[model samples]
Target: KWTWSAVFTLQWLGLSIAWLDGAEVLYTYYYPTHIVLVGVTVSLIWRYYGR
Candidate 1:
């Protein structure tokens, strides 16, 4: 739920950016960066929110 909303927002943002810019940015930066960010965010959520 928590990460869902954040990730969802990022999904749209990334989509918009990719649509506005081009495939270069989407593949070069957005893919790697978004993957790392999602990993980190999920890790943090697990570390702090887990029982």
Candidate 2:
């Protein structure tokens, strides 16, 4: 969870920076996919490690 939080924080920061720089279209378009992929990856990792 902590690791995911950190990754998410950095992701948001980077997205904001890029958005301000005018790359809003790409990020907005892929945001959902990006989030889903991250969530799945983290959950899989956590499950594996937890075992």
Candidate 3:
């Protein structure tokens, strides 16, 4: 179940980043912020469970 949840979380995060990037036609920082957040989330999850 945790693996499924992790995959779902990753997909949702990717979709979120895509949405933010798509929405930020002017304030381009939004894309980078979303990417950073997604990176941090993935890294944290990996750090905790990647062993």
- Per-residue lDDT over 1-51 for candidate 1, one digit per residue giving the tens place of the 0 to 100 score: 766897889878997898789988889878897888888888988988896
The best candidate by TM-score is 1
Q: Output the lDDT of residue 36, model 2.
A: 78
Ranked candidates, highest TM-score first: 1, 2, 3
Candidate 1 lDDT: 0.85
User: Candidate 1 vs candidate 2: which has greater lDDT?
Assistant: 1
Candidate 3 residues 2-49, lDDT tens each? 865775686677667767668554246555655676687789778989
Q: What TM-score would candidate 3 get against the native? A: 0.46
**Each candidate's lDDT (Cα)?**
0.85, 0.73, 0.67
In TM-score terms, candidate 2 sits at 0.48
Identify the runs in model 1 with alpha carbons over 4 angstroms from their true place.
1-4
Count of residue pairs whose backbone atoms collide, per candidate: 0, 0, 0
lDDT of 2: 0.73
| Candidate 2 steric clashes | 0
The residue-by-residue lDDT of candidate 2 on 1-51, one tens digit each, is: 786787778778767766776767547654765687688877989898999
